[model samples]
Target: MNWDDLRVFLSVGRLESLSAAARALRIDPATVGRRIARLEEETGTALFAKSPQGYALTEAGQRLMAHAAKGEAAFLAGAAEVAGQGGPGLSGQVRIGAPDGVANFLLPQVCASILDENPELELQIVALPRLFNLSRREADMVVTVSAPTAGRLLVQKISDYHLHLAATEGYLAQHPPIRALEDLGGHRMVGYIPDMIFDKELDYLEETGVSRVQLGSNSVSVQFHWVAGGAGLGILHDFSLPHHPGLRRVLPETIRLKRSFYLVRHEDDARLDRLNRLAALLSERLRAEITRQEGLS
Candidate 1:
């Protein structure tokens, strides 16, 4: 019935869980339930069907969601227009969602700079196992290796990074020789979980004729740790490798896999000066880090 109720309804509808919606909105689950109950009562239809998995939207709920999305967009546009009267400097909190690797190894220095420049601005760094929905305002911005596919999002190619097969000197010494992809079949391989983004590493290696990789893991950091601890050969992003004495590039200059990092924000978010400034700062900082890491190898 009200904008706040519609906002809460949209959050619950998208996440399909009362608890998740509550957490995202920083409100209690009771409040979220009450708001939804009110909205449903006012509309004279069930907006959601409760299930063990989560809330399932009804047909009427689906119809309302389309209009809710447009209304939310207009509301955000109006808010940004009014905020812009204060000029271009950033204020308030900006939530940034990034994959774990980027959050851990890449964005720290950039975040520090942002804080230094705008002490009044708060930066919320959410380390997602995968990318979040920017269109739904789950995140104000995102940095990812995978390209953005959302129609209403703006994607910028920041820089390219290379992935390399790496192993500890100790492990390589004990394992069978890996002179070519064919030799990798007999050796154990540390890898990402089947459903994770880095499964491409395994697929690519298999396609290159190394069909028998011993799968081990899904976490990139864990895979790297295993490689450093002499567990097995693992494909690692070049930027993730620290100057550990035990770890070395397995094939050196012979094998390389490259992927680009993208900075993405919702197209509707373009008018928000705070979001745009944050995106620009992220792109500049990440580019420098990528260049520095590439130079190291």
Candidate 2:
């Protein structure tokens, strides 16, 4: 019935945890729980179901999802318009999500630069190996491997980065030999676990012509480091692998794969000067970083 209650509900629904919502809202868990209950009472239906895994939206809650989003968009649009009228530069929390590899390797530098410029802003990085839902407010901004063909959001290709089959020099030394592409099949390889890949963009292993995996993980950095530690061979990003001296590209001329980065932001955020500025900054830095990696490699 109240806008404040709807705001709290949106936060709770997005986070699915009372404690998390409280922390994000700068309030107490009991308050968040009470407000959610009050909202349910006002609506005359249960909003969320509690389970060991945390709260999940009920059927009633699902129906309110779009309306809640509309409320959020209205609020954000108003905030952005007010912000543009004049204040300190972008001064609100901005959450950016990306796969673990990009999160670990790329976003730190980008975030630092942003913070340096917009000192008053709060930046949160959701560095996980999952697909973020922009519509669900899972992240205000996201760096994904592929662009969405259908979404009410702004899409931009960050860059086309290259990956190559590689193994630790130590592993190469101790292993039998790798003269050609076929030799990869004889060696122990590290890569992503097929089923756990949350996005189709991460299904890189099937392209490598190696069916079996000696060691693997859902995190790209983990598999990369495993290869770096001489655990096995892996397909690594050119943009990230230059930092590790132990790894050597295998069949540098032959076994390279290319993947593109896509940046997606919600439609509500499109008009926000801060978010748009951030998107531009990210695109620039990403391209520059990829260039730096190119020279380093």
Q: Which stretches of candidate 2 lie over 4 Å from their true place?
A: 17-20, 28-30, 40-60, 80-89
lDDT of 2 by residue, 101-203 (tens): 8888778887888789878888899988988878668888999998888867889999989888888778888988888768787888888887788877677
lDDT of 2: 0.83
- Model 2 clash pairs are none
Clashes of 2: 0
Top candidate on TM-score is 2
Q: What local distance difference test score does each model get?
A: 0.77, 0.83
Pick by lDDT: which candidate is best?
2
Residue 4 displacement in candidate 2 (angstroms): 1.2
